[model samples]
Target: MATTLDISTTYYKSPLGLLRIGGTDTYISEISFIDHLEEGEYQANSLKGPVTPIVIQCIEQLIQYFQGQRRFFEFPVFQEGTEFQQRVWNELTAIPFGKTISYLDLSRRLGDTKAIRAAAAANGRNNIAIVVPCHRVIGSKRDLVGYAGGLWRKKWLLDHETKIQYGVQTLF
Candidate 1:
């Protein structure tokens, strides 16, 4: 018997936008802010089910993040990519809350300053949005750069986190 992979999906209505989360029960595979999920992911897989435990956990943590009650995510995220891309994602998690780092600096930390462009490319390919903290990355000049979810969303996330960390409230 050929067994199909067990994958599930759920929609999270976040302050930013509608998020489509897809993955297995044990780990989150892809989290996109857009309503549409790419092909061959949990959404397109043969076996579809209700939201898994990990997906529920991810949504809960995301709520906490937006509510300013959480700075780090603990859910297990399942992502398959090149080794360099994996390393880039791992480094993104280490970026402090409300803090931003440049792609050049990130590549430097990875021990290859010449790989800055490659690092940026990997950052753009990140599947897990807020959980992986890809929005925390910026241009070398401290300007906002590439973001799959859109530049406005990136700015909003930064502003939201910075405001909460600094203990300020705005009428947004």
Candidate 2:
């Protein structure tokens, strides 16, 4: 039998865009750039206050991220996917902030150099954005590519982290 969870959802207006955060009573299950999702998925969704504990934690970490104070996320991230995809997502967390890796490299890291397409597919399916760091996966030649959040936002995130990496401040 499968587990059934009553999901709580809320939205946060971030520097990049509006984000929808949702989870069950125990752990955060989804974080997306858009607030829109299938109606049926929202059936179990209980709208949460902006300051709910999990929502507050997510917003705080994201704020700290934009401010260059957070390099790693602390809140639990939950998602359901194939075993391969779960592995891919788990590896995404290992990518350090302020860094970029080629999708080929990510594929190789997953133990199959020929699985570049598969790796990219998994990256595309990732719903938890910043926390999962899917944007860190780039093209072979270091070109920014394949960000569901748009390449502009991807560039902004990479540039933002790079600024923090090089300690260039006075503007974010």
Candidate 3:
């Protein structure tokens, strides 16, 4: 018989919007913003099962991050993707906090300047949002573009990080 994986979900009311955090008892599987809680979904801190430690840690880290008290996350996150997508996500993590990288630059870093579109596609498919820092990727012209969470929220997140890192209000 095959054992089943129990996936637990919880909500977080972030400054930007509502975020849904999902994970197993061992590792976090998803943390993405939700416009609103769906019916039957647990509210913030009202988790049903034994809450995963990593999920709680992700929430704490996110709180600290919004408060400008955390620069790096220590929680472990897992996302299912192709090897190429995995490579793209891994490169995204290397992008320093409060900094931005262009899709072209990202492709070059991946050792394929022609793979810009592929890299950007992988970025859009990233399941883990802020933790993976997909918002940090910008267009080649230094303009904000292609954020799955909406351009306004992307700008807000970049501005937030800039203020936290440079003590300035905004970068753009």
Candidate 4:
């Protein structure tokens, strides 16, 4: 006999875009942006096999985040990655909600400034989006760069966080 994991998925319409949320009953596994919601997809409100509590919580937190009423998330997330990638993703969580860290800085934090490219690669491979917060990483020169969700969305997220944290908008 083989064991199987029961995963529940739901969709959330966020201010940034449509998000596909997936998870087991205990922990959220993924929250990636999608260009469109596929037909017959289970939305947050749909009764689909007793929707996971964590998934609902994720959607609620995301909603609060977009509304600027929440800064940090409380739901647990589980992403599968290599040991190095795990380290990089873990470090990303430490980045303050509205603060940005350069790839060089992230690499240095990982104990090797030479691993900048590796760090950036790990950041890019992150499956969970806002909660893991890959958008907080930037270029060493403070330039906006490399976002799987698109640079425009990255810029918007940065500006939104800045406005919420500092009462002013960021130009970059």
User: Which pairs of residues have clashing backbones in candidate 2?
Assistant: none
**Please, what are the lDDT tens digits per residue for candidate 3 over residues 1-172?**
1123476777888998888888877777788878755575544445645677878898999999999999899977788889999999999999999999999999999999999999999999999999999999999999999988899999999999999999999989
Question: How far in Å is the alpha carbon of 128 misplaced in model 2?
Answer: 0.5
Give the per-residue Cα lDDT of candidate 4 at 8.
74
Tens digit per residue, CA lDDT, model 4, 55-143 = 88999999999999999999888888899999999999999978999999999999999999999999999999989999999998999
Assess candidate 3 and give its lDDT: 0.87
Model 1 pairs in collision? none
Indicate whether candidate 1 or candidate 2 has the larger TM-score.
1
Ranking by TM-score, best first? 3, 4, 1, 2
lDDT of residue 2 for candidate 4: 11
Q: Estimate each model's TM-score.
A: 0.87, 0.85, 0.92, 0.90
Could you tell me how far off, in angstroms, the CA of residue 88 lies in candidate 2 after the best superposition? 0.5
Q: Which runs of model 3 end up more than 4 angstroms from their true locations?
A: 1-4, 38-48
- What TM-score would you give candidate 1 relative to the actual structure? 0.87
